[model samples]
Target: MDMMMVIYNGLLSDEYIKGQATGRIKFYEYPPTGDISGPYIVIDPLGPPQSADYGDNIPIKDDYLYQIDVWTKNRLVTKELSKRVQKVMRSIGFGYFAGGVDEYDKDTGIYRDARRYRGKAYTEEFEI
Candidate 1:
């Protein structure tokens, strides 16, 4: 299954995320060119899914790592969204790996809050 799609759908499925930033999530290395603009999010895979568990010579569970960047107009919004994002991800079985690297984009005047999560699960458990 597509892991990034799963993460994107997981975020999209949350009520807070739905109401706060519907259709504002992007799954790519670069944010789209002025596409719907800032106050959006970007999800990037940090590494390929690796086999975590095996039984009888078969892989039963896989591990995944992804970085989610929250972009907004100010620090308060970024922090609030980052908290909601962390909660939503944990609810979906992902655990926080790193986070809260807040920065300001001089060019766009947008605040970026970067966070990472790691999860290990059976491939079927991720079905959305």
Candidate 2:
């Protein structure tokens, strides 16, 4: 399953809209080039997927771990964005159990809060 697409769609869902008063925000799969404004989210896979036991080697279920970074000029805004992201991911069936402010870049004046979520997609049946 395309986990990034799932996350992107969830952020644009109605639930996210009603949860915050923030204006139009940008979302990127990876870091973007050129000048950009505050209040944007970046979704990136942390690393390669680790093996989860697949009974009978059918591969009916897949789990991926990813990182969602919320960046903004204001610390409070960053935190709020992170919370909304967590809610959205949860709504989309992702299990988000760990996250926190990873770092603050003084050079760019951006506060980034990173969240880790495990997304699992399963099929009822799969042919070998």
Candidate 3:
């Protein structure tokens, strides 16, 4: 449930900023926050310095945090794709992603109360 998307590069349209124009800016939810960083464009106090010690660098935030760099063209076949993604998450009882709790319910079949989803005892199985 973490499917997000954002891609705007229409020639960098002068970094529009008139009431937060969003004619089509998919997802720049605002992130840049001072001190220069990398990759988020729109900060050229006079454009030029981008090396000799973080010169033209201005992107500590302007929204661009996509994180997920799991590379593997065949790094030992990624341990067989991580054991086939935990063997399809154990045939449908997903036992990981504990950022919440034992959760997985393709409609109703594996939910060790990830904080009881929304209550009503949540479905999938977790009756204790």
Candidate 4:
């Protein structure tokens, strides 16, 4: 399965996340026109996955980097949502890293807190 899909599914399956923001977690970007309320999450790829290690000219494992952004109008809600995202990602076996916060958007009144995680998964391929 694709890495993002795996993470998305995991988040969807999480009881806390599901109960709080059912069908609100979006991949890549949010919908152009819809009820884009606060307290939603957006998953974005940081970059391409890199080979964690190689053996006999083959990649044994791959490391993927991703950023989960929690956006909300309220500061307290933003913190809570970010914590929920962190818990979900950790439960999925991702290594947490220091993430930065963004300045409050005056125009949209949205506050975004982003978290970065690294997930490792095995891969297999054979040379012909």
lDDT of 3 by residue, 11-88 (tens): 122232211323322232322233112122121111221222121453221211221111122333333323333333
RMSD of each: 3.0, 4.2, 23.2, 3.6
Predicted candidate 4 versus true structure: per-residue lDDT over 16-86, tens digit per residue:
67776777788888533333474688888889989877788878777888999877778887787778788
Cα lDDT of model 1 by residue, 1-128, tens digit:
77777778888887777777787787865565333354688898888999877777777888999899888777787888888888888977899996547788677677788999999878674333
Rank by TM-score, highest first. 1, 4, 2, 3
Model 1's lDDT to the true fold? Answer: 0.79
TM per candidate: 0.81, 0.71, 0.17, 0.81
Q: Kindly report which residue pairs in candidate 4 clash with one another.
A: none
Candidate 3: residue 54 lDDT (0-100): 25
The lDDT of model 2 is 0.67
- Residue range 1-128, candidate 2, lDDT tens digits: 55676777678774543344234433444344323364667777776655554878756666778787777677887787788888888887777757555677777777778888887676435423
State the weakest 10-residue window (summed lDDT) of model 1. Answer: 29-38
The better-scoring model by TM-score among 2 and 4 is 4
Question: lDDT per model, in order?
Answer: 0.79, 0.67, 0.24, 0.77
**Most accurate candidate by lDDT:** 1
Question: Which scores higher on lDDT, 2 or 3?
Answer: 2
